[model samples]
Target: MSEIPPFEIIRASRRSISIQISKTYGLVVRAPFSVPEDIIHAFVDRKSDWIMKHLARHTEQRERKNNTLYYLGHIYPFEYNLLQKETVTHSGGMFTFSGKVKDSGMEQAALTRWYRKQAQIYLSERVYHFSWKHELKHRKIRITSAVTRWGSCNGHNDLNFPWRLLMAPKEIIDYVVVHELSHTVHKNHSKYFWNLVESIIPDWKAHRRYLKEEGWRYALPKF
Candidate 1:
């Protein structure tokens, strides 16, 4: 029989077996404490193909993220200078930084700070431009660190957008801005809500498709 791939097994007070794979943790299996070791082994065997596929994906994603950084629909070469300094700079298609970035954690934190600042400036401007053009009255705008959503509109009329949106093209950014602003008028995604979005940006569907297919690649690394 083929050897089962090495994985960490955590027996916890849980109801079922679960598996996870990531760049940091290669493969992990969580099972009920009462499950037999043989059963756990069998489960892993059954999931080996899935585990291998995800492991390969994680590996490729890590390599790509490490190699490049995306900003404003442009791919920039990320450069780090060991010399201590205060901020990151972008010029000539490169993001250069000279700071106390001794590790990947520090680098990711500094990059996130820079991206958030840019998002605050750029996204706020787009939101205002669209709101004024469409007569949408939103209470406030906030930049968020949300991973799953590009933007959201709460009951208070406040709009929140993920800082990672700065990495997408301006059209995609406008689509998200218009989407949330439309929420100020229509709380749900009824036909009217979609119609409102289309009125503002007729090509919103194309932007949505691009974001759906490619946006995840531009998410800030989790270090």
Candidate 2:
């Protein structure tokens, strides 16, 4: 057998193996415990075309979304028809929330805690419903402050969601839930995986637009 290009492989206890080519990260292979390097490379070489296509498409989509940003003072939807009210009041310091609470400047520490609590209640229920409907299995759910990602899933099937998601609309929050759950089935952004996502949330495009535009602001908050 020929020596394949250098790439990363994630080995775990599973039935079938899969390979992926990323836009920014390049090729990756997730295999079961018994699959050998030579065999995995052979599989990757066999499906290189499919990998390239998925990677290109993923990159294109990411590039398109990158242009959007959520600057302060911009309006974003909240539960029901309540818009997130952005107010810079004079008190002590930090951010604060009133009606919808786009960004309430009271204190970063207090605001972060409040955001986490909100995310816990909101994200968990959505995760429960979607997971049940799709019959997807996962371990636990958690909230954190991630720099770039909105949500992520570990190999243990634990889901981590950014508390900042509370700044966005309920529908956008649901989109993140569905997107993360989709990872449980397909770990990469392949064609089949996106197809599965579309089947679940048909209007994912709008949600994604909300994220790219409104989500950018949350990511850049002082807290």
Candidate 3:
């Protein structure tokens, strides 16, 4: 016998349904356009276990996100290759890679510096292109090695992107840049915000999925 569930339900004008049970925030339900309230409540009750598991996982993730980067001997990728390598550059900005180091502090510093520079170059150029195209005036874009967030937008419209984004493909990077810019118009991830995103980048769903699933592959290790 299931007692009448007491949970706040949110119905969106989209084609998906979800139930969120936050530890501190409590239970919240989201349903597709015009879903009946009774049906939504039934759905939440049907998947109570799953909702609890996800909420637990989300709590764990939030806790982990609060930690800081150690930046020890963790390996970081330069290009698409997963394996860490000894990277070097020629006269031009052209880069080359070999393999990882054993215990050379000098080599590690050199590689880290190179990665930071590369991140700056790649992120700035891409941010500039999208910012201009969307007419989303922003203060400045800089790449930092933040522990958690991929990117952020400040009150002044200053956009900050994680340097790790450079490790992914250009399309993924574009999605991040566009995501921050979209925030300038709508600060939250409301339906209108998503609509604004789809208007600019029609294939945004694929990119969003890629970032959520595979984007972590591009993240540098503790180093």
Candidate 4:
């Protein structure tokens, strides 16, 4: 018999027993009041292995989110700077910051402005490069501080991309640029739309998966 670690059990009106693993709470069991103590214990005992696995994962994720930063598809430890010419700069595989990078509203605003500036310059260049290579025409490139989406294409043929995307690797950034530009020709996600994306980026599927799975890293520290 496997030994289940310490856990908090909450009796509620829910229909089914559910297990949750949290960094703050460790293992938690939620069950309807109708479930007996023995039944709840047995259910949790059965899931002890899964509980341990997720606990470890949560610990790793928490440490990562606390101590590291992401840019260009790589994770780097943060180094504080008291004096520097730039508000933020990346060099030698690390990020050096001249001021408070977290827990401050001012720093968050600075980060947003810096990233949007970079996104405007980098995404625009990629858009122009691809547009010329494929003879795709578009009206303009716009950088946005969007939270819910990565990019959008409007009927005006203008493309909009989130500033947070600059945190991704160059290849992932290129994939998104190409994706929105593809909308210039096909507005919907038909086979023709994806086929065009695949034409430019043969491994487009991998990039899309990266964005879906790793998009959480593309955020500024909370103000």
Model 4 vs truth, CA RMSD: 3.6
Q: Is candidate 1 or candidate 2 better by TM-score?
A: 1
Global lDDT of each candidate: 0.84, 0.69, 0.66, 0.81
Colliding pairs, model 3: 85-99, 86-99
- The candidate that wins on TM-score is 4
Each prediction's TM-score versus the true structure: 0.74, 0.52, 0.54, 0.80
Q: List the candidate numbers ranked by TM-score, top first.
A: 4, 1, 3, 2
- In model 3, the runs with Cα more than 4 Å from the true position are 1-87, 90-105, 221-223
Residue 22 in candidate 4, Cα distance off native in Å: 4.7
Q: How many residue-pair clashes does candidate 1 contain?
A: 0
Report the lDDT of model 2 for residue 47. Answer: 78
Q: What lDDT tens digits, residue by residue, belong to model 3 across residues 7-43? A: 7777688786786666666678788877887787777
Span of ten consecutive residues with least summed lDDT in model 2:
71-80
What is residue 167's positional error in candidate 3, in angstroms?
0.6
Which lDDT tens digits does candidate 4 get at residues 1-223? 6656777889999999999876678888999999998999999888878777677666657666534667667778766676634487767877666763334565566667877887888888999999999988899899988888989999988999988888899999999989999999999999999999999999999999988866776775433
